[model samples]
Target: MTSPRPHERLLASMMRALPESGIVLFGADSVFPMIAIFAARRWGKNLTVVSAVNTIDPRPDFLPYSTMDPPAGHRGSYVIPMAEAYDLVGRGEVDHIFVSAAQIDAHGALNSSVIRMDDGPDKRLPGGGGLAMILRTVSVVDAWKPVHLRRTFPPRVDFVTGVGNLRHVITPMAIMTMEEEELRVSSIRSGDTLDKVQDATEFTLQLTTKESGLSRAIAEPTAEEIDCIERVDPRGVRYATEVY
Candidate 1:
């Protein structure tokens, strides 16, 4: 079999970093979180993946095209009402929360709602569904985006839907984390260089005087991980077409 793509490898690494077992919360449309749940299960890490409206312990055999729509014959352990989920978030009971960002600034604040282009309602983007509470109370918040562009990793986002509580920001080219309220490049894919990472981002990366080298090498996905991803995403919708 061929090797996993760069993005896949990055995502797999992110998934591996999750706690071995706990109550994890995944975004409705987040791809990596779902994949990570499947990975954790496959790796024998007992975890309950909580959706915004349901608790998926022992996730479905077939991955859903969207979190709101589960596959045929799939069942969740119990339904998590919106109110209950929000309460859990408010209580800070959720171990980890995974979210996808449209725009993330240096302060780790994210803008996933409202048209950031001009601030008006003309092009209203998808408003923050549960990010506000999730960011405020979730112990760990991981944000990711499929795209790697200058506009995506801006110095500052125009609008803030969720502020603070960002732990990691995984992208196609690198893995970024906040340091001293500023975004720092922590790791880079094998083919990606410091110059490329800097070109794609707007913030000044803190590379020197770090524990790891300038760019922490991102390892390739193992065969077992590839198999898990294949089984979880049978239609290959998440992996195919090089799209999220």
Candidate 2:
């Protein structure tokens, strides 16, 4: 069997962060909705996807560019206003939410707003549409970044758009979690090392240990998980670069 690609392994890692039986609300990004659907199918009958477009429970046949895209909500059981969905989050009905950031800090505060520049015009990113409320209310927030770079994981974000319930930070190279209110390297991806992760990150890398007193590391994506990702996203939408 062929080895799993970085995105596939990242997707599998994201899937593991999800609850087996709860409503998972996905953010309006390129990759996470696909992961949400895979988790729903793999876990079977227990996982429900509340798409970013407010679809109650969508089972999209193919991956969409953004979760807010209409095709992402295709074949859904029903639709509800986004306000209602936020209500669900406020009521603690939603167990988990997937969020992304243009920049994230050591404290897990996110910046989806503008990137400050001293020499030139500041770059305005896609501002947090509803991230402030969702991040604050959701029980768990799993953030993913396709690229693992020093600028992406900074010691402090340029602007704080959201900062609540951020439990895990998933990137192409590693999986980090909150420890003592600071982001720590919980698991390095298979074939990746702490030195590589630290080189890509702006802050110091602190390794987390398992209950058995061993270091935590990401398991290679199982063959079954790779197969599911391939089946759902043959066009490789998950690998596409974000416009913003």
Candidate 3:
């Protein structure tokens, strides 16, 4: 199997930090989190991966590339309506929620609503399918963006689909969490520097204590983690999404 890509490695790093057992929900169409669920399962995390379209606890090989596609085989253990799936969030049963981001600000506010470029405003995005409810209900909300660049990580978002529940933001180069309601760098991907992360982010990012003349070092991806990604995504689909 080939090596994992930057985003895959970042996802694996974030997912590995989850507690051993809990109900984890992925955004409707995101695939990298799906790969994390499979990787967590492979490592015997003993957590349930729930989805409304496909089956719960879906096998890696059985999973499809997009939500619009049909499950290949043995999709999952059970199927439920999308409404019922969100009900889990309402009841506070979900421990962690991962959603995609069109734009994220320094305050962890997310904008998956519409794209307003300098030339002109774009059409309203499909927006967060059920993310508003999840944000209000779940304690731990994570935002994942495949593209890690200035345009994507703007200082402010055009709209706020959800607010005040962000725990971490995972991008191709780094993993960030809120520190005192502001974005702070927690861990960076292997070979990536803090300066690189600061440059990519449009907002000012708080450095970890270690980065600010402290006697500690930020953690980077390990060999075992890259191996885990290889095992979970041997075909490199998760990594390929970064390019295409």
Candidate 4:
């Protein structure tokens, strides 16, 4: 049997990230970073795509073929700032945001900073880019909205750096979300079960069933879809493990 590919897996992961309505924002290229370049064209067509210049690298087809770039001073329904994406979340211009966390906690707090080890630090990641304020603005306080976090690293986050609307979490093994400050496991990846997910994470991640009973991972990849992922990111990095 053929395995799923990366870009396609990215798209499959993104499809699960979206809401049926309202403004959606993406923080980095790791997930659905921009609307103009939203990566969902291959699986289906006749989909609505909003384009943003100050955002992540978009799918090439969105360029001269399907979508027209936004003109200067255009106000997109949902906005993403390529330069200051984090700031937009604080102001409430975004309803949902997909961000990669250095480490995340059961309480939904994020830590984008690095671990201070004996040798200064092993790596320096992007520090809390407006995450604190965004967390305060997005959490149960501001309209009680939902945020999604994608982190491969775990164990209650080394430090609390950033914050998202923090509705759910997507990892290589599972899908999870917060319910009133409690981390709940959403769903297991397509091929994996809850036990497998628990074994992979560093911390004790609470698993709950997502409303959508599917993993962001391709339930079943098409020959073309699998081929597409190989053509783009041949390494076969799958990002969308959680469908929440």
Best by lDDT: 2
TM-score, cand. 3 vs. native: 0.85
Ranking by TM-score: 2, 1, 3, 4
**What's the TM-score of every candidate structure?**
0.89, 0.90, 0.85, 0.61
The reply for model 1, stretches above 4 Å from the true place, is: 118-122, 208-215, 240-244
lDDT for each residue of candidate 3 in 124-208, tens digit (9 for 90 to 100): 8988776677777886777877767887787888888878678778777777877777888887766778898898989887765
Task: Summarize candidate 2's per-residue lDDT along 122-165 as a digit string, tens digits.
Answer: 99998987789878888888898878989998999999999989
User: Lowest-scoring 10 consecutive residues by lDDT in candidate 2?
Assistant: 207-216
Q: Best by TM-score, which number?
A: 2
Check candidate 1 and list the clashing pairs: none
Error of 4 at 123 (Å): 4.8
Ranking by lDDT: 2, 1, 3, 4
In candidate 2, clashing pairs total 0
Any residue pairs clashing in model 4, and if so which?
A: 36-51, 54-82, 111-161, 147-165, 147-166, 147-167, 185-206, 185-207, 185-208, 186-208
Please report the TM-score between candidate 1 and the true structure: 0.89
Q: Write the number of the candidate with greater lDDT, choosing between 1 and 4.
A: 1
Provide C-alpha RMSD values for all models, in order: 2.7, 2.7, 3.5, 7.5
In model 2, how large is the Cα lDDT of residue 37?
A: 58
| Between candidates 1 and 3, the TM-score winner | 1
lDDT of each: 0.72, 0.78, 0.70, 0.48
Model 1 Cα lDDT, one tens digit per residue, 36-151: 67766776777777764466563476766666665521567777777887887789988887787778888888887754445454456787887887888888887877777888
